[model samples]
Target: MGPRFQNDDRVRLYREMYEQHGPIAPVVLPGDVPCWLVLGYRELHRITSDSALFSRDSGLWNQWPNIPADWPLLPMVGKQPSILYTVGERHHRRSALVSDALAAVDPFELRDRSERFADQLIDRLCGRGSADLIADYAKELPALVLAQLYGFSDQAGAELVPGINALVDGGPDALRGRDRVQAAMSGLLTSRREAPAAGVASRMLHHDYSSDFSFQEILEDMMVNFVAGHQPTADWIGNSLRLMLTDDRFAASLSGGRHSVAEAMNEVLWEDTPSQNIAGRWATRDTQLAGRHIAAGDLLMLSFAAANADPQVRPDRTSFTGGNSAFLSFGHGDHRCPYPAQDIAEGIARTGIEVLLDRLPDVELAVSAHALVWRSSPFLRGLASLPVRFTPTPTSAAGVYR
Candidate 1:
């Protein structure tokens, strides 16, 4: 099994494969889908950086046209009418639209919203001695913040997350989750058109930016942003908490004022990146890479998780990698995550988790690290629930939500 396909000890599997098979190893996926898994750090950099040779457009894939309707990997590799599926000038144009919408957002506002939401969420469970941080605190933080970016309230955010969660769950009923997300988005678009607001959703509907993309096209990009932003941001928060609470390095750094929450975030990104592998990129033509023969239209999976953890690179895991650009957490080249989403995601995770640590000073995991359940998603790595226990710490003279 590959990184995304593995439920337990995923990193170990990727490492074992890389050690045994060298950089690029051809492997069969769950449904007997054959593809080459790229596990070398430098090799992955080369493939992702040279996008011209390795196309993101699924239309270029020779096999997809003949693949069965229920191909298990379709949900992972399926192309949408969005930037995620386009390349060249078309990719640039759609990327500009997403970037512009994100640019309009204020990062400071995102930080404030994150802290506020954390306060509210923690306030609910701090009275009790225990809580599930994933479900109760970490999971919804990104969705609620994203909702604000889209000009909606927490009520709308709450309605949208369950469906998105299901879609990413990679189960047989993923379509039901997809349909729910679409319905929620359609309703949001209708609501914004009916009563315009100052968020991204309303702006997409009313702005002159509509001149670039049709209303439907705008919705497609927003769906991408929503799904993309929520999963990783939520995962990063959960992962960051696990690292900070359990890892001695983080504890020492934070206690000694040597590291900020952002440092912990970068460490997590470098170590256990939200998604172990970026989805399959088809070879544009026959080419040789890392001593392996490559055929046209063959699937190439970039193991960002494996690469970042490569011993040749990260020989010293204790060293800080905040300045390291070699870690492809946000990816590289034309397909990199939008700058705004990246910024907002980091801000959300850092600010939210930092707030939790400050408020719940004594919080610790309720179960052993090995006992925590990893979420099953083709595109993300996150825990299903982060159950935690802490003394019932009350807020200052100010109210709990304060």
Candidate 2:
């Protein structure tokens, strides 16, 4: 399961796993750590729905004794002050604080800001005739827009991009990247505290429940929100564009008609969601799941991709999903992604894609579609680089879209 997670063709891998082991299967993580993967749609829904039995609190993990201090996955799954591990009443308050802060962001402003940043990024490479969409466009857009939303200047936001990317990639630099992002968030918190303003971080600082938690803990929550928002949204843009470029059904999106953009984005969420798998819920007590004997303190990985592909729900896997939104891409139940955050991600990703198509109407993949490479991350699914070519449009004409 550890090596299979990095496989480029994860769809087939997930299908094989489901066929071989049913909905719940025992597997070892990268560090030889053991856990069960929830692969069935109904099974995942049940686990996420019953948070009392399957808890978010990672401290309940029984394998802690075997986990080394320097374990690569510690930063992700290990107990942390962030809301990801918080549970019960306190978690509810924290969730409201984060959600309200994000919800206050004006949707109109978010869309306009997304377009502005998308253009700025595309403007940088519009005259080059060729570019890596991942590096130049998709990766940088989300954080820049989020920076402004979080009260950071564009310069500060731009500075944080590389570190945020490295952190989400879960590479050797992940810890270092996490440190850099935390420092930046700390600075922002200090600034917002000194002089409050209209931004997500400021709103979070002023939330009624803000006083309940220490400054460090709130800062940790801020980091989680920002990171969670950034990478997945970026991958959404990249993956949706990959689909639009390769699939005939969405080619109309590149030719001035805007109708297919939404379909492509929605379809991507179903077929190739950026968040393919999640670190997951821990068993609070001994329980039976999918006819398997699961003991207390056992870790359960949520396989969103597999769940979405479950034959029981999606009988015809090859059929177009269209407007159906039952996918678990953003998760479900009590711990699902905040509704406001989901809207923000959707706005940024959809606006980014629309703006790109309007600007470079003739854009096409530079290499054979088969030549594109997926980033080798077990948790994330996105292209390492989406090399593309288009007729050069001068920077001076950037605002003049088709």
Top candidate, metric TM-score: 2
lDDT of 2 by residue, 1-402 (tens): 345566556777877888899999899987899999888999999999998999999999999999999897776698888899899999999999999999999999999889888888888889889999999989999999999999998788889999998888778997799899999999999998989998999999989989998899889899999999999999999999999999999988999878899999999998888998888999999989888999999999998999999988987878999999989999998889999999999999999999999889999999988888888776778989999999998764436322
lDDT of each: 0.78, 0.90
Any runs in candidate 2 off by more than 4 Å, and if so which? 1-8, 396-402
Once model 1 is optimally superposed onto the true structure by TM-score, how far is the C-alpha of residue 347 displaced, in angstroms? 0.6
lDDT of predicted model 2: 0.90
Question: By TM-score, how accurate is candidate 1?
Answer: 0.90
| RMSD in order of candidates | 2.8, 2.2
Report the CA-based lDDT of candidate 1 relative to the real structure.
Answer: 0.78
